[model samples]
Target chain A: MNAADVLDGGVLDAARALRERRVSVADLVAESLGRINAISGLNAYVDVFGDQALSLAQAHQTMLDCGYDLGPLHGIPVSLKDNVDMAGVVTTAGSAILKDNVPVADASVVSALKRAGAIVVGKNNMHEFAWGGTTANPHYGTAGNAWDASRSPAGSSGGSASAVAARTVFASIGTDTGGSVRNPAALNGVSGIRPTIGRVSNGGVFPLAWTLDTVGPIAKSSQDCAVVLQAVAGHDPRDLQTSAEPVPDYLAELERPLAGIRIGWIHDYSVKDVQPAVRTAFEAATATFESLGAIVTAVAIPDLDAIVDALVVLDAAEPSALHGRWLRERGDEYGPDVRAQLEAGFVLSAVDYVQAQRYRTHIRARFAEAFRAVDAILTPTLPFTAPRIGQDVIDIGGRDRDVHTANMQFTALASVPGLPALNVPMGFDAGGLPTGLQIITPAFEEGRALRLGHRFQMATTFHLKAPPR
Target chain B: MDETDSIRCRLRAHGIRETEAAVGLAASWLRNAARVRAVVEEVVGPAAGPVTAFTHVPAGLHGEERRERR
Candidate 1:
């Protein structure tokens, strides 16, 4: 297999190859560093730890010589979103305020990945503080979309998605609150999961929303995500929010057959809001699921628009609480847009905050009732292909639409419900850019979503589509 | 909506201090939302059940520690 194929291959496949000693760790890290250097214009990383990643790979090689080995990710290089803390590295959430902020220890997920024998290659850029969906960072630099440099890699986890899609690394970890991970993954034609809340401990990652924030992986396929999930999802005493449940064999779940799986078609949920390109790809995805022997039905649980407001209010409130003092003292350090949103969060009344929580409880119950009749839900991942840079709005049809609004058209619902959602690349647009079809499962049913995604990925060629350098 | 006044009220009431511009935008959203809510009430009528909330925990289940019993 070519270096791209090996790097982009399933983590299990790579592990088997590593176990057999067919591919050396030194060589793999070299190829990844080459890919990052080749695409220097994407600016996917805030700092590329070339020496550190190489040193780790060498250490893994020595481990093999000594007849000792780490688990599945032995010798694989992984990039981390900047918001995640790593000892000796600055955790600049793509802003000047924290640009000089260096961490003395690793984030919980970073420690987990290291224990699995993965190499931390570098820190990825983001839309400052993981607040906005687009990955455009005026401070560090926007991580350009893999297919088109003119368009964005979706953020605030854009850097992680682009680095993986462009073959800069084997896999990367990113945060998802209101679709930070999945948005860029879809935009870049890769795979990412927003695992159920509290499944992965958030201990070391900077807080976006103490209640809603989650850190997840962006990888080449659902299988890759499953491996990363195994490494990262666990309870931590530092993060009391983590569930005390045991981690399952996510890789085994991927091989589960799609037969008899009931996937609900949320076609009309926001059909009017989605772009025609996304709408078409979603229909194709539903057909693919049916052809695989999965029964499908139309269902509507609750208005997503109603749930979105509750999620937004709650998300903004938490982040604003953490950053309010920073913003007040160093207002100029923040980007104008982030400042505006943070400011708005402060004005929300205590009653309004309480009411949003109530609304969330009500919606969760409503969705639980719907899930009783269906195993999964399928929807468009993003409403359209990437819009050009410098244009914060798109003229969809005759009316002007905000780019942020259009980007989250499909993603916001899952975020609000705190359910598991996967963004799997479905197909390319006419311009060769990719569009993703989202597969969503009810809270804690990530295995089912991965199974469905893995099945479709095996049956289709979209997951293999690569952007030319 | 002076920053100092807004900050004082939010801090005292909710332990938060906010900028004036943020409050203005929030107020705009609140105003529009209240209008929409009132209209919905006119059509669907007032809620028949109490607005159940989980604000104050029961004495036995009070804090994150949740007073575990042997």
Candidate 2:
């Protein structure tokens, strides 16, 4: 099969075709690189591995010819967020400070993807140091939204989501700390799964908030995400944070029936500061869940306001500590928002940081208590749709607020507690932007979230609906 | 000293050159910290035992630290 045919079929489809010898591996990589170059205006990629990708594909094809099965992701084109290491490539983390900081070894996640015979198409652009909600990086040109060229792709994982939405790559890995990965996916109308903390290794991935950080998949659909997860989710010796817990067969669980599954709808958390469009879409999503034979019930997690406040402190403080010396010496080199936030961290007392951590312990325990009663919790992935590029302030729910604060409110529900949260495309709002329904499962239970998401997609055609080309 | 002055003093002590916006953000976080503590007190109760920070790094990885502490 030709490049165009394989490129249009997506990651899982192309992988199947490659295994059957219906499509050439080299042809798929070439098509992915061509698409990357064609959509260069989106600023999705900071670096394109055209030569390396082709070489890898050729090698994988030879292995396939020798009757060697490399695994599910064999011959698939995948992008890594720039923060992730690719050995020889400079892992910029979208910051000038780390502009020339190349790693001597591939990140553990990168090794896993390579082992699965996946070609690293390029390093996707992100908010500098994965600090901001919008991909409006001052150092690198902003990553444009796939749906509308002029709008923002809510990020730190903006480019990854944009690339997936535009169908440039089958999937991309992005780190989530306070809604980075899932935010971009939600805004761009794609599947993004932030697995529970320690479920996936973070060995070579750049840290934002070490305690809250997680590497996750941003793909065309939840099933595609599961395939990627199957390849990458496991205990890695390199990352101490990776739990010894066994990685479940995520793809196998996707086909399970949703009948009798209890989905918790935290009414207080779900409705707070939610935009009218989002509220409408989320209500419809819950109704659809009920129709699918899943029992959806309203539940509560206490001290939510305190939890949000604690998250802000922890998120800001950790990055501050990570970038403290740089902020002191090269303060002017950082982006305005990042620099300001870093400086704000220095202004915080260690007492405040400690208090936030203490609060985090309290919040996690509360979530643990709530999860015992339900299999999954449901909420809107974002409070509102993607905002216009360079738009910092927005009127959400009739109250003006910082765009990042507003975008993070719903996604943070999962992030703060470090749970497995999956964003599935629910439907489009009145403004034509996609709305995402978030399904959050208990820690280390990614299969539960993916299964529910897969069932939702099977019942509805939302994930299949492409962005307006 | 006033709140702004106190914030400026704190920033200076931290070796961060104070700007109006940075000071403002700092003061805001300080306010948030107070509110957070209040909520924690309300929910978990005062005289609450100190909770260690959330960390996923396994204890085995901190063997060196444990040894050093001993």
- Alpha-carbon lDDT of model 2: 0.84
| lDDT for each residue of candidate 2 in A1-469, tens digit (9 for 90 to 100) | 7777777655667777887888888988888888899889999999998998899889989989898878878888999999999899999999999999999999999999988888899999999999888888888899999998799998999999999898889999999998888889998999999998888999999999998999999998899999998888988889887888788788888877888877898867886788898888888898898999988898888888866677788888889889877877888899888888888877677888777776766677677666666678899998888889989888777888888667778887888777789999988878788889899877777888888898898888878767766
Q: Candidate 2 chain A, which ten residues in sequence have the lowest lDDT sum?
A: A365-374
- List the candidates' TM-scores in order: 0.89, 0.94
Model 2 pairs in collision: none
**lDDT (Cα, 0-100) at B4 in candidate 1:** 51
Off by over 4 Å in 1: A2-4, A397-399, B1-70
Worst 10 residues of 1 chain A by lDDT: A302-311
Write one digit per residue (lDDT tens) for candidate 1, span A1-469: 6555678677888777777877878888888988888888988888988998888889998997687878888888899999999999899888889888989998999999888899988889899899888777868887788778888887889889989888888789999988898989998999999987778989999889876788899998988898899889878887887777666688888887888878887646845666667777778888899999899898787544455566667777788788877876787777867776787776666666666655555555556666766778788888777877667887654567878667766787777667789999998777888888788776556777788889999989898877887
lDDT of each: 0.77, 0.84
